[model samples]
Target: MAVNRACHLIEELGCGTVLNGMLDYYPTKEEVQKVTVNPQRINKLLGVNVPMDQFINILERLEFKCNLISSDKLELEVPSFRLDITEDADILEEIARIYGYENIPAADLEGNATAGVKTENQKFMDKVKENSIACGLNEILTYSFVSPRGVDKINLPENDEKRNFVKIMNPLGEETSVMRTTLIPNMLNVLATNVSHKVEEAYAFECGNTFTPQNGLPVETKKYCIGMYGKEVDFFSLKGIVETILNNVGLKGYEIESETTNSTFHPGRCAKVVYNNICVGTFGELHPDVIENYNLGQRVYVAEINADLVFENITLVKRYSALPKYPSTSRDIALIVKDEVFVKQIEDIIKANASDILESYKLFDVYKGSQIEEGHKSIAYSITYRSAEKTLTDEDVAKVHDKILSELSEKLNANLRSN
Candidate 1:
């Protein structure tokens, strides 16, 4: 073919073409490939069953050599120059190309479409929102894109991981240029807006995703934030509401750990919720500086929880029993300890030493004044003792109470506050 083309080109020009010692070295031309063709398979793929003879005729017209191997099967030899034809599907495609696609029959799809339902994760999120609403908080949604100044406003340290945020290359403006790392700032903005409107009380929560700069792409996590500011509301009051929401979400065996160094919150007033040795959330009064930054005239409490962390520690099994027929007894014990001691530490010691009859316990009062040393505070708890098998005896309650006191005194350097 190349020699003929060269001869034709020479004839068109004045130069004459002459044959010399021509060394043709066309390296490794493709060999003819072979594939087995099944008529039933082709029929299934095409939807219309073309007869065996018709299928062979289609392949022959496409320059594919076909040999009958069985009553319903044929071996097809693909043209060597057609390197793309390597499989039965390829041969079928060649037949289809020659047969024309428009000639293929069309049929309507046949199946019943089932309605979609909420996934477990979606259902649980709904439950969380329902419980948050039940606890007197209206849900709010804010843009995940926040200003880079948000971290500065929250007073995050230079080395904080939340400081490493994903930047939007084409941002709307500087105020919305970066992804949010914490939802507390957004919640605070909502409170600040309410304050600007002269609204007295403002309690709102947001459930949304926060982005953290990772190795390549940023990591996204769902976070839950609750912000509160109003009359008759304090740190502990907000803590109660948080606890109620967590309880409703079926979380148990969690500990309240004091976090006194976070810049986003007031020192000594912030507490972290820990489950299985992981910090799932932080809640407390907002730092005075942060409140001032947002122009919130009064103290504002905020709780920001990692919803994924909470989801990991949520209890799935629920056990119920008939109402206890046995009567329960309560005991009040006060311990004077260093001001740095958290309620969680005291409760941990109590829980470690208490017997199985220890039903529940709660911190009722915290005192720090002249009645105690300058560096010390007195904390008290009301413990209830009961048993499902039988009513707890005085001796049983006395034994557990003494053990708890001993543990607190030995482990925490706590002095019994007896008047």
Candidate 2:
């Protein structure tokens, strides 16, 4: 609109004179010439018969019009004929631009901000954090990138995703060139940092994603990792922490069988936390060699929980019982069982034979010594029985005892020793 108006105003005037040349009032000589030549070229390019004399006078008149337009639009008339604004349409568009976005009405949205509840995956992460914290673990944050060479220090899965790292095109340094595949490396780095700073007794946890390449595509997996460093940190400490975490996350009544699964941890001191027959996580003492490689302050208790598996469809159903009103009998029975037998199997057998009056049974002693035969060990279990109905005669107790012995002998092939 402004370009057509300028051309019309110039056509009204009759003189072939360059109207404006002062640097302050207009542009440099070359810039003024470029702007002045535009109308003439437009006439030639479009084959419009625009007289130079008339266009010159029209430009002179436009100086006043330009002042009025500039004042009305609150625009600064700079002197440069910038290449960006070489086209008349560009100049005209700028002069006609308006700021009225506020005049537009907003469209209604379907869901409000209150609908932002955590998704299933987020809920899993929340449970992991909550349970870990409840087990005396402090949440921690660390950078996802680490030194590529540092990965060789970790004893992870042989065909681990860590072997394939995402390298940065432009990194701060080699130390931060590759994205970490597991939280353990970054966690160990943090521990080393604290150790260097003379701080000890650290218990930290992180819930984050690890990157892997699956069939030539980048795959990110989220895991919840925990590390504990202190003089007292050991496999049992990590076990207790994992148990507490699982319980808090509605994973009560689950089991952790002592089993060797990873090289980063002590083989004999490790166990997998299982819920609903699925392995949710692991607990163990960090391998002494790994500790030395990372230069950690002390032996560390470590556990990693896969948040996804922690929240199985298991329910936290619980029942309560009143205190015993009658006298309770406590008896310890030590039996020899084959190494192939699991304690849970023994417990199942005990529960099967014992009456409902059986209050509790616990395995307190296990032995494979000179006094015991090879490949067989003594498993000492404490059994407590109390009758909810009555404190009957010795005959009733003896009857149940005999039944327990018979069941053990028939099922577990056990010998009952009365000494």
Candidate 3:
């Protein structure tokens, strides 16, 4: 047994030449420091009744030589195979394991436990994700790294700020050589792939980060993108989905302004979503050129929202108001205005002039046909007036409704359309 232990220790300690019968093994200077063990500590930790002589006998069986250093402490020469035996507790553990694990009694843990709660930010993200999934849009996860050609394919202008993307120094290939500056290109690719595989319609969304180069470093911004393509999808279809998400997130006072600046979106069909005077994102129909570039055979409507900005401005503290006690009055007004006058302008005019009485107003119908004049279109709007204190009669609603029509006519050259 001693010969086997010696051979194993020599092999482990890299003293192979000692077994070749040429040179004797000499301990290195660092190995001369002996490990100390206390029999009293072992007995206390393991709850064992072991004498000093019994401890020395057990260590000798494991090929560890010991010498008495004090009344309770013994200096031990640790063998190479038992490299883990460093401190007094480690030697105690070895004695317990070899002696018997069934000998030690288990005790209950003692501490006070606390429950966890989600932070406001985590709760906000969870709500946003829930609303997105509820809007018939499946959530998708895509790679942050994308091809450099994606920017070019989107038809972004040369001077467009989004054209600036952080390049990967050690890229795996050309396809993934740069960080994505926009999620639209990847979304379009996904839709195109689905269409190629005979899938008729696809509605998907992703909430992820986009990278942009700034001041010789990469800046990450969180963004949410949604893409829908099918026979039934159009500008208004996707617009309603966008509104649903924003409303559910408890955002207010945001407007979707008609967009004409981006070449990637079809002209006159896209709009920039604005909140608190900040352009949060853009949504519209994909331009024919962009769709063709991706080989997408069908029309596509996409919207991208700046999630970071939205979350920063989100009102997590909700306040509830009691329902109105009195009935509200509604009036319909149809006007023929030049095509240049956007619906947002009319809505803003009504909202500005109607004051506190104007509960809400919405565009119900927009018509442009051969029966209408060459340069003008008929737009119909429904305006509602209500009072918190009492019911509003027709006379009261007509007063503010006429004021809104007058302002629309004067400011936008809008003329009241006859039935």
Candidate 4:
């Protein structure tokens, strides 16, 4: 629904929390170092001035040694039991709590309160979820941190970039020991679980983040994925799902071509989604080895989209135009090309030669049988012609139609289907 730059951000005014703070923590075993405390800073922060003597007395009663090194500063030795008092802010909060928080009269909050609203990127993802749900996919969420074994499970190569994992120094367990570079493993795990539970079929999607290790930091990239395993699932059905999302996002001049090299997917069944010559996604049925690795009994299909790429390229502004007033004419043509010829190749020829009056064309049928020659196939299309200035006569439409057929014959060696 919208385009967003960078990751979603919150411009908090007075928070001291660092975004890239360390996750690893090691508690001291022997003793905590003495905290450098300032009574004036405590008072300024808490907005209540208490005399230094009173501060020292209150801490002493709590079994703390407040050795005054300056008029306003003290080298405070915390009680052995107060192991949490390792930082000055911790000691300040303790003083406030002991001084009775109810006694400090509350003042009006500073500045204006910012009303929470969804970011444009957040709204776009929400739209993706809704549209996917309408297409009959159940929304599912999986953990960002997953086992390192996932890379192996998918049979990624040794030099694959996904093998560069952001390992957790203190993970929950071995299963959650590394940040995910791809959602394929998680999706496979989900589909595998459903089969284990004896579910007949599953169609699920996730719009989430994938972490890529970049220059010793985990860079968050948004990803959208769909996984399905059922008697109803097939390559073309999954392709339809992909096309629906692409059109819904308003992309143009995109290409879907065959892919064969990815180890995770079945060769010849996989295809990449490219827009403006940039590959934004890959989708296909699982390789037989992958199916065995996941212990899945049924064939599975998966699709992954670099949603960050889509977010960057999507155009939210839609133009409007009135319906055509003049009558439109239609033409049905069937042509035969070699077995190796792609539908897009024929379409390219038609589009290149068609005149301005050619409004649209749709593939109505494709035939391969005894009536057709071996090592070739027959394809049919219903072409429409119209004019903005006036209704197109049969003679006018025929000239353009003949021109397109001539080009197809010349460029692709296509023959008209007589049967």
Using all chains and alpha carbons, the TM-scores for the candidates as numbered come to 0.68, 0.57, 0.74, 0.70
Off by over 4 Å in 2: 1-114, 215-217, 252-254, 275-278, 312-419
Clashing pairs in 2: 9-58, 10-58, 13-54, 15-53
**lDDT agreement of model 4 with the native:** 0.87
Cα miss at 181, model 3 (Å)?
1.3
- For model 1, residues 1-419, the per-residue Cα lDDT tens digits are 88878877897895885566567797996666888878788778888878888888988877888899886688888877788877788877776777778988788767987669997778778989999998889999999999989888888999998888889999999999999999988888889999999999988999999998878988899999999999978998889998998999989988888888888999989999988888999999989899899999999999999998888778878899788889999999888999888787888888888868888998999888878889999998999889888877888888888988888989899998975
**By the TM-score metric, which is better: model 2 or model 3?**
3
Ranking by lDDT: 1, 4, 3, 2
Q: What's model 1's overall lDDT?
A: 0.87
| Whole-model lDDT per candidate | 0.87, 0.68, 0.86, 0.87
User: Model 4: residues >4 Å from true position, as ranges?
Assistant: 1-113, 364-374
Higher-TM-score candidate of 1 and 2: 1
**What is the Å distance of residue 224 in model 1 from its true position?**
0.4
Q: Candidate 3 lDDT, tens digit per residue, 259-295?
A: 9988999999899989978999999999999999988
Clashing pairs in 1: none
**lDDT per residue, candidate 2, 1-419, as tens digits?**
67556655776785334355333553545534233124434443333444544433444433412222221222223344344545455433332232122423355555755666898667767777877777788899888778876667767765765678877779999999987777777888778888888886888999887777557656777777888788777665776677666666666667778767688777777788777688777778877888888888477777777665555544456668788788988778888877766677778787887878788997787777877778877888888888999985677767777788778878888764332
Residue 105 accuracy (lDDT) in model 2: 39
| Superposed model 3: Cα runs more than 4 Å off | 1-119, 214-217, 416-419
